[model samples]
Target: MSSQCPDADNANATPATEQWTSISKHVVNSYLEANNALLAAMGFSSTAEDAPTTESAVDTTTPSPTAEIAFGDENWVMERSTDDYDTLGVGDYVRFSKPIADTDVSAFARVSGDTNRLHLESDFAEDTQFGGQIAHGTLVAGTISAALARLPGVTVYLSQDLEFTGPVRIGETVTAECEIVEELGGDRYRLHTTVIGGDDETVIDGEAVVIINELPGK
Candidate 1:
C-alpha cells in the first residue's frame, strides 16, 4: 500500500508540475513580447522569435536607407530653417513634433525608473490636480533634444535649463522649437528651446548651449 501510494502521488505531481511550468513559460513569454514591442517602438530590434507583432519593428536583416538627418519617424513632423551644416548660424531653427503616445509613457517609465502613478495609472491620475495622466516633464523636455538633433550638424549638448510651466497630457502632440539665439564661437551656440503642447500651451521653456560639430565625413 505504501509503494502504491508513492506511485500515485508521483503521477499526480508530474502533471501538476508540468502544468505549472507551462503557465510560467506563458507568463514569461508574454512579458518578453511586451518588452520587445516597446523596444521596437524606441528604435530597437528584438531577435526573439516569439516577440509580439508591432508595426514599428525594423527588420534587422535589411540595411536601413540613408537619410539627410538620422532622426524621427514618419509620424514625426520636422521643420528646419536650413540644412547647410556649415551655414548654421543665428536664426537657424528646427521644430520637431510628435505625439506622446501611451507606449512612450510606459517605455519611459520602464527605462527611466520613474514609475510615477500620475504618469502611469489613469485611474490614480484622474484624482490628481491635473485630473488625468500626464507625460513625464523630462520626457516632454526630451523633445527639445530631438529637435536639436535635427539641426544641420552633429549637435552636442553643453548645458540646458528647463522650466515646466504646464503639463503635457498623454497622447498630446508637442513640438519642440530650438532656435539659435547667439553664437558663442568655437562651434558653440546658445539656443532658445521651447516645447508647445497640443493646445498651443508652452509646456516647457528652456535654453540650451550646444556645440555643433560637422557630421563625420562631411
Candidate 2:
C-alpha cells in the first residue's frame, strides 16, 4: 500500500484542504493495518512500519564489493569441483577443513572482545535465545579466508560480505570452500565462499573479492 500522506508539493494548500489531507492519511493508515493483517495470515513476514517500497534519495552509501559478483549471471553454481584443480578458472572452487572447538571460539572472543554469551558460555547461551553455544560468525569468516591463504598467490582480500545462516556448534568440523565467481581485473577475483558443517549444513556464507599476486600452484 502506498503512503497517503499529504504531498509535499501541495503543502501550501488552504487550512481546510490540509485538514482533509490529514483525514485522508488517517483513512489510508487504517486501510493499511487491515490489509497487513490479511497479508500476515498468508505468511508475509513484514509489518506495516516497513514501507513496501522505498528509494533512498541520498546516495552516500558505499557499494558492496561482493554485490557485483553475482550481477550478470543466473546459472552460477557455488559448489566445489571434482574438475581439475590445476586449471582453476574465474569460477572454480577449492575446499579446506577446520574444527569448531571451544578453544577456537574462546581465542576469537578474547582477541575481538565479543563476549556474547551465545559464543562464550554454554550455560548462559542455553538459557538465552540460541539454546546452545555457537561459533562466532567472524571466526568462521576469518577461518575461511585463512584456509584460502593456504593455496598461495593471495596478496589481499579487498572485501567480504558474510552471512551466517545457522549455528556452528563446538566439535563440528566445517569445510571452507571458495568458488571463483568472476574476475574483476588483473589478479583480482571475486570468490563465492561458504563454510559448511560436517552434516553439510551451511554455517557461514560469504563472498570475497581477493587480489592475488599470481595464480595458485604457479
Candidate 3:
C-alpha cells in the first residue's frame, strides 16, 4: 500500500479554493456593475465600489489631515462672515448655495425614505397644486444645516424650528443663510436661518440653536 502525504493534499485544496473565490468575486462585481448602471439611468448615482463586499474590512486607522477647511465642491457656493473661530459671535453668518438637481432629489429620497410622489413623479405632481415636481421640504431645509457647517468651528445643532413658506422646484438654485443673532452662554448661539429661492422668495424660514466647538488640535 502507498502512504498519502497530508502536505500534498492541503496544497492541492488551496489552489481550488482560491480559484473559486476569484470566480465568485468576478460574478459579484459584474452584477454590481449592472445594478449601478440601472440606478444611474433612474437618476440615482451609484457605483460598483459602493456595494459592500464580504471580504472587506472596516478601516480603523486615524485619518490624514488636509490643507484647507473641508467644504462642498466647486458647484456649491459658500460665503462666511468670519474666518477666525475664536471671534465667532453675534452677527457672524454663513451662506451656502447650490442648485437642486434631479439626482439630488433621487438620492435624498433614497437616504431619507421620503418618496412622496410630489417630489418624485412629475406626472402625479403635475396633477396636484404644485403643477410639477418639487423638492422635498426637508431636503430644502437641509441647506440650513449645510450653511451651519461652514461656520468657523465645529457646529453642533441643539434645536431647530422651521416653517416651510414656499416650495422649491427641481433645478432651482437656493441659498441658505444662517446668521448668529444671540450669543447664549457656554459657546452656544441662536441663529436666524432662512433658505431663499429665485426671485428672492423664502422657501424655508427657521431658527436654530447650536454650540460651536474648537477644532481638534487647534
Best by TM-score: 1
Please report how far candidate 2 places residue 186 from its true position, in Å: 1.5
Task: Tell me, by lDDT, which candidate is best.
Answer: 1
Write down the TM-score for model 3: 0.70
**lDDT values of the candidates?**
0.79, 0.63, 0.78
lDDT, candidate 3, equals 0.78
Candidate 1 — what's its lDDT? 0.79
Candidate 3 error regions (>4 Å)? 1-71
* CA error at residue 164 for candidate 2, angstroms: 1.1
Error of 1 at 50 (Å): 12
The TM-scores of all predictions, comma-separated, are: 0.71, 0.57, 0.70
Which parts of model 1 are misplaced by more than 4 Å?
1-71
Task: Tell me how far candidate 2 lies from the true structure as C-alpha RMSD in angstroms.
Answer: 21.5
Q: Report residue 194 deviation for candidate 2 (angstroms).
A: 0.9
Is candidate 2 or 3 superior in lDDT? Answer: 3
